[model samples]
Target: MSDQLFGSWMDKRDSNWVVFAYFDWIYSSGMFIQMLECLSKRWGFGTDDVDCRFPDNNSFDVDDHFSGVEFSYGLMYDPDVVIVSDEEFGRYLDMACFKYIERTPGSAEYVRSMLSRNEPGNG
Candidate 1:
């Protein structure tokens, strides 16, 4: 990936999930896992390649150039879960997580393995 994309990925990975009062998607942890699976398929990553950021109030923007959109959270949230309406947003999330994991020295090995597998799932 290009340095700009890599930097964007890293920024989003470090951002915390915003809890919004307006959205109550009622998603379980299983939803997160399923989302990961879906993202792996769309982004050509792997099932175990994605990671989740802990919930916090920090503001950040996840820019997805592929879909020509940007996902912003935190400022819009109000202590509940922020419901993302777009499915393509998940791919950006996965990319961010993958980038974060891959940058962690020894952790890059796992990312390399996952990317090399090239197994596609339902995005």
Candidate 2:
């Protein structure tokens, strides 16, 4: 297992979800377990190995207030709870990117630009 942490958007059977996953190499067993526990309490469960179908639109949205802290610690949004509307899903996706990837220097602008390009009526 690699030590790096990673995140991505996913879907299954027309259901949409987001995931931030990592191997044990990056987090100690205790810490990893704690993280999962916190996630279960806050957002939802952490899957070991799972597979699902992709969304038809292939786009998501992030809320303006979404912070990356939860995702940085490995949060997976439960499809059942997340609304399927494009605007809301896009907000969630934006939040995930901002918190997970845009934290690094010079990433915010790039991410925002990418998101804008993908938004409806923009392209």
Number of the predicted model whose lDDT against the real structure is largest: 2
What TM-score does each of the candidates earn?
0.27, 0.35
Give one digit per residue, the lDDT tens place, for model 2 in 1-123: 333333333333433332233222223232343333333233322343321122323335433233222222223433232223445545644554455343344656655555666466754
Q: Which stretches of candidate 1 lie over 4 Å from their true place?
A: 1-78, 112-123
In angstroms, the error of model 2 at 14 is 19
Error of model 2, residue 31, in angstroms? 23
Model 1, range 48-98, lDDT digits (tens) per residue?
222223222243543222232222333333322222433434454545446
Model 2 ranges with Cα > 4 A deviation: 1-83
Compared with the true structure, model 1 gives a TM-score of: 0.27
Q: Which candidate is the best by TM-score?
A: 2
lDDT of each: 0.33, 0.37
